[model samples]
Target: MTTTLQINGRPVAVTAEDDTPLLWVLRGELRMNGTKFGCGKALCGACTVMLDGEAVRSCATPLAAVQGRAVSTIEGVKGPEIDALRRAWTELDVVQCGYCQSGQLMSACALLRHTPKPSDADIDAAMSGNICRCGTYPRIRAAIHLAAGDDRR
Candidate 1:
């Protein structure tokens, strides 16, 4: 089957099985490798992507589910929120292994979009699902705080 979805800001059609996970289509068929595959299960947020401004696990999301919806991967996500996150990530040195940074950034972008000034607890809740093997949770939280303009750290 063929499904068309808005990626980043562009609309593109991909031909794949209806149940094909969006992650495979992204990294395989579409050649959009920014979204990584950490686990086939949705337990890992390594495959997180924005589905209509809400982060979803691309590893478990089917292509058919995203038809006509806007999907924003790390490569395509843009705006003031993401820009601030990028700056904060760099300034705070949030990346460790770097494998999970894309998903981490995507989830952080969504949090900032909904809650521009998130407290530490809010950051913890928003980012709890994303696991970094490098144990950069402290830096990740600090980066979110910095991106949200809440530099109380």
Candidate 2:
């Protein structure tokens, strides 16, 4: 099946099965490798991407679900919030191994989009699903606050 999708504000056509995971389609078909494959199951947030402005697990999301929907991968994430996130991630040194940072950033973007000035509890709740083996949660939280212009330590 040829699934037409809106990716990063561009229309892209992908030839894949309806059941094909969006991760594979993005990585294999579209050659967008920013979204990583972690647990394969939805438990890991390493394959997180934005589906119609909401953070979703691309590894588990079917291609059919994304057809005609707007998808934003790490490669396509833009805007001031994302720029602020990138700066914060760099300044705070949030990435250790860096395998999970893309998903972390995506999730953070979604959180900030919804709650521009999130509390500690809000950050905790929003980031609970994204697990960083390097345990950089403190830096991640701080970076999110910095991106939001909170900068409260």
Give a tens-digit lDDT track for model 1, residues 38-101: 9889887999999999989999998889988899999989999999999999998888789999
Give the 10-residue window scoring lowest on summed lDDT in candidate 1. Answer: 144-153
Model 2 whole-model lDDT (C-alpha atoms): 0.93
How many clashes does the backbone of model 1 have? 0
TM-scores, in order shown? 0.97, 0.98
User: Candidate 2: worst 10 consecutive residues by lDDT?
Assistant: 144-153
- Give lDDT for model 1: 0.91
Candidate RMSDs in Å, in order, are 0.8, 0.7
Instruction: Indicate the TM-score of model 2.
Output: 0.98
Q: Where is model 1 more than 4 Å wrong at Cα? A: none
Clash numbers, per candidate: 0, 0
Candidate 2 positional error at 42, Å: 0.9
Alpha carbon lDDT of residue 118, candidate 1? Answer: 94
